[model samples]
Target: MKYKHKYSLTPIAIAALVAFPTAALADGPYVGVSGGVVLPEDSSNAGEFDADVPATPDFGAIPAGTEVGWETQFDTGFAISGQAGYAFENGFRLEAEVAYSEYDVDTHTGLTVGGANIDGADVAILTRGAADPANPTVGAVIADGQGKVTNFGLFGNVFYDINTGSAFKPYVGGGIGYQWVDVDYMPSGVAVGADEDGTFAYQLMAGASFEVSDNFEIFGQYTWRDSTEEAEIPLTLVPATLGVESSQSIISAGVRVGFGG
Candidate 1:
């Protein structure tokens, strides 16, 4: 009698077997590169002279009461970034990234010496005249200018992947970091430069990815990023400090390569 011998796998053993493949698929290191378009919100600032300068009696230059208000609109620009990260079997990931972006100036507005709001072109004329010794009547000039804002950021991010047992994965993430921001303006033919260092920065992101092979994937993402109020930049004669605030949204697409799982 070849008596039948019965054997059964335990629940734990079954679970282990089912999870083995998922663990292998989820554990790995990856590197990615992305490029995108940046759409900026408006940036604005107001400034006044730190101190009034007394005129020399001989020169007869009266103290100029100078104040300025500035508003700048930005055009769409380009953004690029690189990241490296590791994924876990529980669908969590961590990454470090570096990014760069540039935005063009669309418009600049200013306050005039005559206590009226003026266009940038008129401000430029006032600024030019204020710099000339012959045009003593112009107390202050605001200039319309063209320039670019460039920023570099470094961030540490965390994400969660919604794996649906298919080639496609969707994810959501957020990050906090530091940024170096530089603003260069050619206002009234005079160069004005300002920079902020180690400003607090943050971002929110969401995206989906398609696996192309065992070691490669492609993705598209949308992100919103912002920095804390920037440090002040000094301006001419009146010793005014200019302040700027900025933020933007971005759409990006990229490729990623995985290392061993």
Candidate 2:
């Protein structure tokens, strides 16, 4: 008679089965650095000056009610960021990050003085006599500007990683923070500037990571950042202010190192 042998998991096999999942989903602290491109959306209503102001007695040949409109076109730029965070066994993480980026201006158009679109002649005239007491061209419109915009931000983020029981994991996250933005408009011989307050900033993120080792991984992500704030730009010799708003998007890749799970 052939006897049937009882089959069961060995002690080591049982221990391995119990510990595998926990080891795969290790909890630990991590730090990372990323760099990529910054693509900014249109900056609408960047600046506006009153088109209905009377010329001062001291200013010569300066017309009243000259409407000057300025809009900014942002070119793609570079972004770099660093972050530190702690991940939990349930695939949740919390982190703090700081990032910086710079974008070049594509064009600065829509300048009008006394209902007449400003041209190269107008700019030349204004440049020659803008500050001349004997020939003051105060409140003259100067357009077709170019410059760079720089942004620095700090954020607190929360994310959830989707574990797939493989080497690849996907994640979605969001963050809220503060950003400082500076806009510098250089119109050959004129200076018009605007600055954003240390205002509320927020972002949405989605990404995937590939585990190369037990404590190291690489990730790529897309982030949409919104950083609109009330901005005021004082006009030259005018009692009016211009308002601007800003927004941007980014894509990046980086490496993360985990410690002490």
Candidate 3:
């Protein structure tokens, strides 16, 4: 009887040890840093310009036979963001993210004609830094003597994890959010092209999160948004004509860190 009792106790001890390791590897709470390049699937609208004002000193004067063909182009910059998330035992999770990226578009054309085209011939030609509401007159000109537009926003997401037993896990998620933007158009002989305006924006996002360790990993994502801004500009020199409007979508990749159960 004594020998049988000892044998049963031995099996129980072995089972307890085997189960401990598996429990230690499961999910819990954590914090991390995620950063990468942001590439939007839809173009972000920088702003618009519709001014029939005189040119400024910088642009001199309107040239004879001068025509305007303006465009806005986007660039690829860096993205850095921080996020916190929770994973439930059933593989469901919710996350809130705040990411900031420098979104910009360049304008290459803003010309005038049948005028003097003097030393300040390029005056009233709107460029990147025209978003200030100091001089309302300039703002009015860029607005086609009407209105202007600008683009900027914020977002959030939800997802479900795939159970693969392996150390590596992948996730799919979707998000929605809003943006606050500003546009300005100021007129100055010295300042030339100027503008100011603001708006509330929106967007949608989809991406995958990678888990490298129990505490860290990397991810890549794509986002699409509706971005539009308006500004005003005025000319103090020769007659001026301005046209600035365009949109772009961006793409990016980055890494993340985790800290939790």
Candidate 4:
């Protein structure tokens, strides 16, 4: 009886020492801010013109030896976001975040099939020469020329927590969302369209949280997202009426805040 009593007391003592501190460490309701570079993993724009379109302009053979080279490049920019969430004692929770990002692309094309290197902007100017109120064809023809492209979008996110333990918490989550896009073509100076079509966008996120002081903690996270957008081009200089589609993958890191348990 004495030995069994001592053994029961040993188990009770161990539980008292190990369980109390862990219960006391758990907290909730946090908010945080994070800013970083938005890197594009796979970004591309591709489109072709429709020669069958009535607005299609005529291009005659030009002199030989004209050199043309086409190039497209997008500039990197900064992104900042804010997050709020509730941290639980268990290894699970929920979070909401809002983020804003910008990407600017400049496109240049020089096509020299023969000796004639075609200038897309110059074609717009020439097509305008045949301008008349009765003949709106010139405007339509000029608008068909491919020019500059600018793209921007807004995003919202909600994620499920998978990590909540010890001093360092690790988690894995997935989110479904949408992006609003604005696409504009050159020469026309008008927005071809905004892709509010609500196409599906998804992300994979992984990060760790370091407990700063129960209610407060510093966290670092990385996310991978896949999305797509499109721009329209007039058929003036291009071989056909063209629509350019850009496929984008973005990776970003930032901190977040917590609240409510």
Candidate 5:
């Protein structure tokens, strides 16, 4: 009798075979680009006085031996980034990225000279006068010296993909990187001028991706990044130091294209 040897495939084994193709299609090498609206936080200790600066009469009430300083704010800025990475079938990814960002000065405030607050004036006037006390034109233009702060960076990042067994994947990740962005915007006009560029940095992010095709996805993300060190740039017009520290909040969206799994 040709009756036969009974044949059986377990449920788990059958399911695995059926799911193999989808798993393979879901992970691979990918590249992405994104843009963001950036909001920058204020940095303190923006300027300080030292002995080399003459106690000039041009600076109103800001004599020598006065510690020069101010706080700052930025208008809404923009950021762009590009990255390449490999995604594993087990739900992990590694990427390398390059990014750039820029912001326009909104205003300067909290002018403290010799530890005294110079209130009731446009902070720009105070900063300009303090920087170039000899220039009588200083402080007249409330809108003068509208400078910008810019950034360039390289980063290595790692991410964990939360697989929902469907078209959507949510993720959380962080990275450590280096930035070349230490110039002081207020002084840049008189001085790209106030700076000590390059510092260690770090960031944290949360995002979600929607698959547009088997090998393509669109994502939205929110990130917070900060420089781990303070940068001090020597003032060109005066005997003073401009101290800058950076922190930012970003909301962005991008697309990723994938290759072989």
Candidate 6:
């Protein structure tokens, strides 16, 4: 059994600065921070056994190496970010940001052996490497344990503050970045197998802000990001890569403070 985290309060906003943009807030330097909920899409073909497996007591033999696929389902998670940038009087702004996010695994889906789908204890048997004389057969212990995906990212962004009249303002922008994706999973046994790597990534965002004064503004936005390549997580016993790509949607709100001209 797993305890999935739930978010009852909706996100208030998200923000990004662009090089060629129109904006408001402050004319000089500013810093911001935000936190919110994250929902990760299901991943297909996350990874596979890099080599051939002879046979296991729980499941039969599998051949053709990479054709053996691994898919996964994930529960809702959380995300946070901090950024520093300068807003121009002309409305264009450029900034840098760092963010982190995590998701819990619901189950390992779409595992197959000899053209038939395998699940429950059978999936664990193969993942725990039943073929290995060192590992005994693991019966029916799927998702009774733990698994998750963790990510760290850094980005250079641009945003434009749109003129909406009064204290309310809307902004839109995007950026390019790098991501470190990590996977740790143990579906069938007590031991855990993990893998992590870095990749090229990018995101698009939009949000609105309300100016409370000359130096402070409250804001929120929705952000979507994806990796150019898949995350390959290789583990022992499993003998395969968990090929989940780093992708997520974030709903968040934060405050920005400006100083100097």
Q: How displaced is residue 222 in candidate 1, in Å?
A: 0.8
lDDT by residue for model 2 over 38-93, one digit each (tens)? 99886764344454444444334443434455456778998999999999988899
Stretches off by above 4 angstroms in model 4 are 1-29, 47-71, 106-166, 184-198, 228-253
Flag the better candidate by TM-score, 4 or 5: 5
What's the lDDT for all of these models? 0.72, 0.71, 0.43, 0.46, 0.72, 0.74
Provide TM-scores for the models: 0.75, 0.73, 0.50, 0.55, 0.76, 0.79
lDDT of 4 by residue, 1-261 (tens): 455544345887987656544432245666777766555432233444333223324334322222222334445545566766665656555556665555554433443233334443333323423324454333343234333333233344444444434556666766555644344444344333233223445566777666654455566677665554334444334343234444444445555544445
RMSD vs true structure, all candidates: 8.0, 6.5, 10.7, 10.3, 7.3, 13.6
Instruction: State the local distance difference test value for candidate 4.
Output: 0.46
Number of the predicted model whose lDDT against the real structure is largest: 6
- Per-residue lDDT tens digits of candidate 5, residues 39-121? 98876745665544333343443445567766667788999999999898788899998988888777665656677665544
Query: Model 6, range 113-171, lDDT digits (tens) per residue?
Result: 44446553333455544444454323234444368889999999999988765568889
lDDT of 3 by residue, 127-191 (tens): 32343445243323332321223444455656676666543455666555554433222222233
Model 2 spans with C-alpha error above 4 angstroms: 1-25, 46-68, 112-144, 194-196, 235-239
Residue clash pairs of candidate 5: 184-194
Residue 122 in model 4: shift from native, Å?
A: 7.1
Ranking by TM-score: 6, 5, 1, 2, 4, 3
